[model samples]
Target: MRAMTYDTYGGVEVLSETRIPVPKVGPGEVLVRVRCASVNPVDWKIMAGGLDGLMDVVYPVVPGWDVAGTVEYVGIDTPEFTAGDEVVAYARKDYVHGGTFAEFVTVPVRALAPKPASLTWQQAAGLPLAGLTAYQLLTRLDTGKEDTVLVHGAAGGVGSLGVQIARALGARVIGTASARNHDRLRELGCEPVEYGDGLAERVRALAPDGVTVVADFVGGVLDTTRAVLAEGGRHASIADHTVLGAGGQWMWVRPVGADLAELGRLADAGQLTVTVAKTFPLAELAAAFDLSREGHTAGKIVLEV
Candidate 1:
């Protein structure tokens, strides 16, 4: 099997395409013939050693978490799937272990879910990790039609789906994005608020009572978000905010298969969409990582296997 991997944590340049033996399925696991894999900021973060404190991946680790693939083999204990089932999953490879960046990967059967029928492998590849994050955060708040929620970074991978999911849940959605995506946000049923230059004020002009919940995928300068939230509002962020004040709840998201299943259902129903902004072949994994880290991608970047 061919894979792009790094022997040590460093910059993208450390990544190299090498011939490695394909992973094998163990008990309760399935071997997947990868069709596509999603590139996420965490992939770059781990590659650059940003998460060394939390993950102990051995040297020469592959770096991807989201996969949309076909089951090529099944482990003895994995009865739920056969050798030809299509699946999409958050494979938990960011920290250590093999990942979807290769021609094949072995993932726990519990982590895999049937890919949405409405999506190609390329689109479904973008959904597992980011979609699950959005699902868990929104559902945690129990937000309803009566509530108004603000989604920061509304045009990025997770935020894009978050906006749609909020609307599907009947919340009044206000999204912060660059003016370029204003129409796109509106299409997702969110009133677009241009970020920066009095972002809170802009949101206030849209919702006089203030946003009752906020999902901040972006970091820093969240005092404005605090002001936008009504008292007792909830805020969820993927980024670390050491100085965030206590006006509302703050949390970090963890991957949940149940949440990804729900997201997959939404996609299958044509109620959600995964936008793939860019794609690269497995050989160009380094460029894919660079694109994801640039912070301006319109949607998820993918690695086609």
Candidate 2:
């Protein structure tokens, strides 16, 4: 199997392409023939040791969590899927190693979902981590039709999906982005607000009473979240742990097959969509990391295997 691996934690320079043995499938796992894998900020962050204290690392690590691929072989006892099944997964394991950024990767059945027929491989690849992040956050907040929800960093990968998911749940969505992305947010059924100076006022202009739910996708917006939340509102942050101090949930997306399958159903029903900002070949993992690190792309950065 061809994979992008790093022997030690460092910058993008630590990543290099090499041929390694095909990972052995264990019971309750499946070996997927990789088609496309999406890049998340956490990919590079993990590569650079940002998660050193949170997750154990193994050397020669293959770094990626989002996968869209075909099941080539299913391990014993894994009866949920079989050969030739098209699937997508948030393929993170308990340890940092043997990931989706390769020709082949083994995924536990717990994280795998059938791919939606409406999406291309690249789009499906982009769905798992970002889509799950938004879905789980909104779910935890118990969003509903009567609520006016505000999304921070609404044009980026996770926020884009957050806006759509909030709308699908029947909530009125106000999304924060740059002026250039406001129109895009509107297309996703969100009222767009420009983020920056007076962000609170802009959001308040749309939801005069206050937003019933706040989801912060980009960090450093605790103040803005505080400014516009309704008196009994719920809030959460994927980027900022300080949210915990503010009566908000600090979340890390979990790989639940049922949740991913629900997202697949949303895509198939035309209630959800993924934006692909750019695609790179598997060998260009480092370059992809650079683009993701730039933090300017509005959609997902994917690698076509």
Candidate 3:
């Protein structure tokens, strides 16, 4: 199978197209013929050694976690799916030896969910990781209709979905984004606030009582979160583990079939959607990683397998 591999932690230049044996399906795993895979910041972060101390890695690492594809084979005892089933998965394994940027990727059945019928392969591939992150954070916070939610980086991959999911849950959303994305935020039913030195003041102008839930997808806004939060408000961050010291949860997204399924259901029901900012062919994984590293794309980048 053809896959992109990096022999060591470095920049996008380290990624190279190579042919390797297809991964064996371990017990409770499935072999997916990948149609598309999404590029996330974590993918590049791992490639550049930012997460070196936190997780073990094997050389010639295949780096991607989000996949939308068809099941080509099922592992022993994996009865939840059969060959030829369409699926999407947040295929993060315990280690980083193999991944979805390939002709085929192995997925644990527990991380597999049917792709949303309303989404294209590119969109489905984009949904698993970012969509699940937003869904999990909001659920963990128990954000609900009565609450007013403030979403930091609300036009980002996870933050954009956070805005939509909060709206679906009936929360009043105030989203912080660049002025360029303010209209997009409004389309998703959020009160758009320009993110800058006066972000707290902008959010305050929208919600005089302050927000009840804060979901920060971008880091370094802890004080701003404090400034705009109402008493008893809950907050969390996916980017900053330091949040744990300040009464907020620092989250790493988990690969859960149930959670992905819920997100898929939301997409199929028109309650949620995934946006693909750009795409590259499997061999051009380096270029895709470059785009992700640019850090300004408002939507997910993808690799077509």
Task: TM-score each candidate.
Answer: 0.95, 0.99, 0.98
- Report the CA-based lDDT of candidate 3 relative to the real structure: 0.93
Relative to the true structure, candidate 1 reaches a TM of: 0.95
lDDT tens digits by residue: candidate 3, 1-305: 99999998889889899999998989999999999999999999999898889889998899999999999999899889999999999999998889899899999999999989999999999999999999999999999989999999999999999999999999999888899998888989988888778888888888889999999999999999999899999999998888899889999899999999999898988999988999999998888888887899989999999
Tell me the spans in candidate 3 whose CA falls farther than 4 Å from its real position: none
lDDT winner among the candidates? 2
Tens digits of per-residue lDDT for model 1, 164-232: 899888898999899999998898888998878888898899998888888877767578777888877
lDDT tens readout by residue for model 2, 1-305: 89999999999889999999999999999999999999999999998889999999988899999999999999999989999999999999999988999999999999999999999999999999999999999999999999999999999999999999999999999999999998899899999988789989988888899999999998899999999999999999998999999999999999999999999999999999999999999999999999999999989999999
For all candidates, the clash counts are: 0, 0, 0
Each model's C-alpha lDDT? 0.84, 0.95, 0.93
TM-score: model 2 vs. ground truth:
0.99
Number of the candidate with higher TM-score, 1 or 2 = 2
The Cα error of candidate 3 at residue 110, in Å, is 0.7
